[model samples]
Target: MRRLMMTMLFLSFAVGAAACGGGAKTTGADAEGKIKITTTIGMIADITEQVGGEHVKVTALMKPGVDPHLYKASQGDVRKLEEAELILYGGLHLEGKMTDIFENMAKQKTTVAVTRDIPESQLLLVDDGSGTHDPHVWFDVKLWTRATETVQEALSKHDAAHAAEYKQNADAYIAKLRELDQYAARQIASIPEGQRVLVTAHDAFGYFGKAYGIKVMGLQGISTASEYGSKDVSTLRDYLVANKIKAVFVESSVPKKSIEAVIQGAAKQGHEVKIGGELFSDAMGPAGTPEGTYIGMVRHNVDTIVKALK
Candidate 1:
């Protein structure tokens, strides 16, 4: 009887242990057969989903309003990344704070930088001696096309069986981006040549200006950590008065106080600078919204800039 009870107790313990172990986390391909993908930002996730189609399941670590510059991965994020078959992130230090983490994961997993293959000649320099290229490539439709292609290629290489489908989806998406580029150019052309200037809270529009034929001025430098100089603000105010510039815009991810200060400074100098519509900078719009999509966000920005500056 003692041996029988001991055997029964061991069986009970084994059952409980197995049940607890079943809850251990897993990633990559599940029983459903989808290739699990993880991206650091929604923009990457958007393209990955568009190109990957039925073959991949994508999860983005950063939500709509979250700033990637300072975002730190939590334990949950680490688990998701570890479990993913392929992890994508915006390169050139866009995920500045998470750089070390990305580097470490690359050794153990198939990690890709969406902007890795973009030619250095095509990149804008930081000019602050950082020697790093701009990470905000998504702001320009033409430049963003390269990012899309990179995502498609990464997905294809990992899952070659779906290569043709990825290529097809990528072609469709790139065509849409081309249309967006043309639309932006057309809208910017409507603004009087001399008045085609975009002033914003930060220097995030360098790529936008280069691609769309508008001159961009910002209160802060490339990174938000850069100081906002009072003398710089004063100079911009005087320039606005001299140039008769009527509007300045704010960014969704950046605070508006600096821009408000610019407006007030311009007002003191007798120049009426109106608040143009808000622009999506480091992030896109909310999920399920038009601006949430890459094309939609670009269209919204172009329309807002043209309507205000025209």
Candidate 2:
């Protein structure tokens, strides 16, 4: 039914755009000569701004603390998508509800998935028999560098005049991400190996664990759209008691109630588990905050995890 609603919304917007002569379509830049780019999530927006530098004016459709798994596009979002000279999004069903909208928009404008260039072998399967790969690629900074490159290449191809600047900025941004990847590795290593278990409200941090040599367990599945029951809570509680895991983290975009329940459950089992810290999972922090940027967000997550689990 939600998918139906999204489809209907897209159809209505498509008709409106057609009626308005393709919504006065414009490309390459606005009056300020800045490439008008629209990205689906804050992470992509940050990367676009970082790589495009002064040559792009980027707008993120989703704000901080938004869960992209169930995000639906509003008519206003359609307008933004229509107005953008170029559109970038995290693919692999990250923006699950908005996939059709993006697919249709790609037919009308330059739309690219930042994760398009990532090698499939590096992506983890959901293990749900759906053949779906995990969409939280940013948790692994090295993989996210490919996303940065995709953004650079997309911007360069769309606005060839600033190709050189885009390349330079992207290279610099990638270098910083490499440093962040190293930092995450070093920090995660500090946690006692046996206690290197990261529990969260959801399985969004699988890639983070894979990258940093931690065991990640979440009460919920890869997508928060998947429901969790009391049985799930009890199961997680059992694991915490069995492994003597000290802390579990809550996600900014997910409800704390789930983790709070896990904490209570662990307490009943005579194993106390505290919320290590709130990690940025599906979303980053507020616009001007340090955690708002991708690099800052990763650092905050790594530091939070190390402090909690060490």
Tell me the alpha-carbon RMSD of every candidate. 4.0, 8.3
Residue-level lDDT tens digits of model 2 in 3-46: 99999999999999789896555655787988898999899999
lDDT (Cα atoms) of all candidates against the true structure:
0.89, 0.92
Model 1 spans > 4 angstroms off: 1-22
Which pairs in model 1 have colliding backbones? none
Model 2 regions more than 4 Å off: 1-28
Error of 1 at 289 (Å): 0.7
In model 1, the number of clashes is: 0
TM-scores of all models?
0.91, 0.91
lDDT of 1 at 74: 97
